[model samples]
Target: MSSHVAPDDQATSGLDRRGELREFLRSRRARLRPEDVGLPSYGRRRVPGLRREELAQLAGVSYAYYARLEQGYGETMSAEVLDAVARALRLSEEEREHLVRLAQPERQGTPQAAPPPQRLRPSVQHLLDGLGVPAYVVSRRLDILGWNRLAATVFGDWAQLTPEERNTARLIFLSPEARDRFADPERTALTAAGALRMNAGKSPEDSYLSSLIEELSQKSEEFRRLWARHEVSCGTVGDIVRMRHPLVGEFDLVHESMALRGGAPMRLVTYHAEPGSRSEEALRMLASWELEPRR
Candidate 1:
């Protein structure tokens, strides 16, 4: 099979890390009000959220310094300064980490090289085959690497999708079937966007990753809006995903993701229905059904 990387598009090859950091900081600041950070609301403002000078005051930095930082001159910023800005913005733990990543990509580590085609180990595939619940493994890019029989039954057959189409972000944002299957497609979109944003911060130089984000941003307006929010998910585990399976009707399943040890940054994601609930019965029915062989 061919690599999943999109065809070479010079426009989307490299991420503008400084641009990302500036926008992220701006987004975080835009969410807050003068009152939110204990500053008194003053005269009518043209824009939403606290003013730049106000944020500078809150972060205990000069307005000129903060303005430069917001304009993507953060390469020389100290950790203490970044931390202060994070606290001032009232960023969540994941958001804080994301801020550090964007502001100090060099400090974080070397930009990762483009990874080779990902494959699941035989033992990992065996583990999936043995599982009773719907389960799949996904790469750091949210690419579907492997899945079990029940997962295919519950989530639609991944075997039907092209390698590029197997990505979770692509499924959520680009697939018409996903809009119908997900109980809250909007929430799912937000989660997917957040995860992608976090990954982009970590590997700003990854061409495939940059291309995926560009495609999603251009194709999905909802994804574009969510991406602008600058939300980040340190891990993929998210709220209970309520799915409306075509065969089994509607059911809620708790989602969990864990990184596979001693390997690439692949995560094993599993969905389990609450015990003794109608959802469990639905899942059981899916497991019992004889799924058609993969093409």
Candidate 2:
């Protein structure tokens, strides 16, 4: 069936939830194999992941019904049907919620507008300044709003780069040096892309976000490929992150993200190293490398 934009999506949701749902479902489906769901391996399949017929069988629904829903044009989907699909897909809480929103955005409530990324309260800046390790604040669009000296030393000096270059998503996908900074580039990009997807759902009309995505899609082939997968994630375990900083050759760091009080949408992220470890020593070295910003 053709993936036509639903009238409801056109009239109400402006974030392309139909396309999101279609790819999300297909991506999840593609990750599974016949043996994964206890199904016997059958004839050779042209495409990867479980076939539509196989999934339908597992979800206790007809192939036609499953196909239509997968295409993101379901009509009055029952709660039971959704629950069954969730179970079949083995989706986590966030993934299930995302699915529900895409399947029936009409049921979802209107979300609040995200504040300006450049606007940070003085108190929040103080909190960043007080942090011993690398710390920075980010918007839903992943803009680097506020950051301390440590962040500059470790994550690179955003002052030198343009405002758009400071975005985590942009840095991860568009810049090769930034991608090399992370130990697991693929995982980093995938999770960041997922977070961007989640953020787009909430703020569908953000022009900056739209432009950033378009630029990445056009510039980087890998970003375009990963974006097509529709894999989504809120965050990843920061402990797995190993940064190859210029001052410190290789140091493992754990990231901590907190929602500052009165800052509903803005978040502060701090990096920490294990106590008395080599990484910790490297962090100290990084701190020493921090220089005063030019007047």
TM-scores of the models, in the given order?
A: 0.91, 0.88
Off by over 4 Å in 1: 1-11, 234-238, 293-295
**Residue-level lDDT tens digits of model 2 in 1-295:** 0011233212122366676677779889998998989999888889898998888999998999889998888547887888788889888877887787778766677665565565688888888889898888888888888889888788776778877678898898887877777778887888787887777766666555666676766676777676676666657546447788766689888876766667647778888999999999998987887477521
What does the lDDT come to for candidate 1? 0.80
True lDDT of residue 139, candidate 1: 81
Can you list the residue pairs that collide in candidate 1? none
Superpose all Cα atoms of candidate 1 onto the true structure and report the RMSD in Å to 1 decimal.
4.0
Give the best candidate by lDDT. 1
lDDT of 1 by residue, 1-295 (tens): 0011223212276667777777778888889999888899989998899889999999999999999999988888899999999899988888988888878777888867447547789999999999889899988788898999998888788899889899989998888885677888888888887888787777777778877888886787777677767678733465588899878889999888887986567788999989999999999998889887473
Q: Over all chains combined, what TM-score does candidate 2 have? A: 0.88
Worst 10 residues of 1 by lDDT: 1-10
Model 1 residue 292 CA deviation in Å? 3.2
Per-residue lDDT, model 1, residue 150, is 90
Error of 1 at 223 (Å): 2.4
